[model samples]
Target: MRVSVILPAKNESEGLGRVLPLLRSVLPEAEIVVVDDGSTDDTAEVAAAAGARVLSSPYSMGNGAAIKRGARAANGELLVFMDADGQHNPADIPLLLARIEAGFDMVVGARGASGQASTGRGLANAFYNRLATWMTGHRVLDLTSGFRVVRADRFREFLHLLPNGFSYPTTSTMAFFRSAYPVAFVSVDVVKRIGNGSHIRPLRDGVRFLLIIFKIATLYSPLKLFAPAGLLFFLVGLGYYGFTYSTMGRFTNMSLLLLSASVIIFLIGLVSEQITALTYTRPDRP
Candidate 1:
């Protein structure tokens, strides 16, 4: 099958200079598309000089936005997405592609603990993986790895569900599990990124990290998250009511409020489940 390797870059001219040539040496026949996400540097020129097809945005779009643009523009049967920050090794492309050929719809390169950029990031990813595993009832080795190869057609199916921000990998991974698509992971190591430091700011993206937790549940199965929450509220309400009846001999407003909240949360989960089901219905399906 034909393959397209997409690199999303922003002010990563130095990284691109190194990555592009290595990518060419590995998959010479594959279509290499460099998405220059409004870089002030010479990212586009560097990619062009190395014989990669360049797609440039006038202004900075987020990493996920660049990914969507590249996916739409690629004309390959398989789509390979990796960071242009020099952390993702080009040699690992074939390992992921092999899994794609083995009947998996998507294959992600899972990083070991040491591969994480920092201690905090590693811990955060560990939490995401565990939560996703519980949500999907399948072990998720890596829920946020950017290096992945997927069948182009299947990948594009979830394009509308993908966010235009940093959490695209998280969103897409959960979507695949929800849709029952076969996904696999292969362990890989990463090196320190070249050029400028990470674009992600801990203070700014912290809120986004929290949103990703909610997104994971909502994307795969909202009931998994909401049901437990509702149950907790119900238990608290029941306990409070029992206490009040034994002591004050009355059903208090606090008990009523807790019970009401429990019911409302469960109802919301039910509605969200239906909506989530509709989200996965293929447009081509009747």
Candidate 2:
């Protein structure tokens, strides 16, 4: 199979210098494409020097935008996406490829304890993994690892839904699960990034990751989220009504409100579940 290796870069000339060489050595037959996301430095030049086809954006779009551009330009049946910051080891490429060859629609590089940049990041990843697992009913080894191999055609289907930011990995991973595609994860150790600093802001990205919870609910199973919430309100209303009737021999407005809200929320969830199913269903082609 023709494979394309896509590296998304932004002011990552130094890291690219080291990463591109290793990729070339390990994946000699693969097409390497480096997307320079409006880097002020010589990132495009560095990638060109390392024999990688360069795709330069006029302005800084985002990491995910770069990925989309590279995917569009690549002429491969399979696509591999990895960081340009040297955190991903090129040697692990073969492992992901092997899993993909074994009939997996997507193969992710599952980061171990040693792979995280910090304790906080590790904890955050753990939370994401658990949330994804709960959402999909399948154990998620990693939720945000950038190193992954995906079938080109399958990956392209959700291009319009992908955000133009750092959370593309999260979006794509959840999407594959919702679509019922075969996915696998292989443990991999990550190295320290070569660059001076990371572009991700913890506070900002943390909030964004939190929003992924809603995406997970909407993507795979909206009822999983809405049902529990409705149930909570329903239970609370019932309890309050019982307590009030026993004490004051009266039905309170608060109890009625809660009960009404619970029913409304549940009905909305049922409608949403149906919509979600229709949205994801592939229409028959003539």
Candidate 3:
């Protein structure tokens, strides 16, 4: 199958200059597409100089948006996505492709502990991986790794589901699992990023980190996350009601509120579960 390597870059001219040549040397036949996310630097020029097809946006659209643009514009049967920064190694591309050839629908280059940019990011990723593993009942070595290879047709199917922000990898991985598509992980080590420092802000993106937890549950199985929460509220409310009835011989408003909240949360989960199921339905199906 023909392969397309896609790199979404923003002010990464230095890294692209290093990565693009390595990519060309490693996979001469594969199509290379570098998406310039409105970089003020010479990112587009550097990519073009390396003989990669360049796609430039007018303004900084977002990492996920650049990915979507590259995916839509690529012309290969297999799409390989890697970081534009120098962290991801081009030599490991073959490993991901091997897994895809082994009948897996997608293959991710799972990063080791040493590959993380920082200890806090590593810890956060560990939590995400555990949560995803529990939600999908699969061993998820890396839930947020950007280095992966997937069938273009299958990946395109979920373009609408991908956010324009930073968590496209999270959304795509969970979507594949929820749809029963085979996904595999191959261990890979990453180096320090080249060019400009990481664009992710600790303060702003930290909030997005929490949202990713909710996104994971809603993407795979909403009930798996919401059910336990509702049960917790129910149990607490029941205990409070028992204590109040024994002491005051009356049902208290606080207990009533908790009980009502339990029921509401559960009903919301039930509805959300149905909605989530519908999202995975094939468009051809009636």
Best-fitting candidate, measured by lDDT? 3
TM-score for each prediction? 0.98, 0.96, 0.99
What are the lDDT scores of the predictions, listed in order?
Answer: 0.94, 0.91, 0.95
Better of 1 and 3 by lDDT: 3
TM-score of 3: 0.99
**What are the runs in model 1 whose C-alpha is more than 4 Å off?**
none
> What lDDT score goes with residue 59 in model 2?
100
RMSD of 3: 0.9
lDDT of 1 by residue, 1-286 (tens): 9999999999999999899999999999999999999999999999999999999999998999999999999999999999998999999988998888889999999999999989999999999999999999999999999999998998899999888899999999988888889999999989999999999999999999999999999999998888889999999999999999999999999999999999999999999999999999977853
* Ten-residue stretch with the least lDDT total in model 1: 277-286
User: How many residue pairs clash in model 1?
Assistant: 0
lDDT of 2 by residue, 1-286 (tens): 9999999999999999999999989989899999999999999999999999999999999999999999889989999999999999999999999999999999999999889888998898898899889989899999889999999998988888788998889888988898889999999988889876889888778888778778777777889988999999999999999999999999999999999999998988899999877766676511
User: What order do candidates take by lDDT, descending?
Assistant: 3, 1, 2
Model 3 off-target regions past 4 Å? none
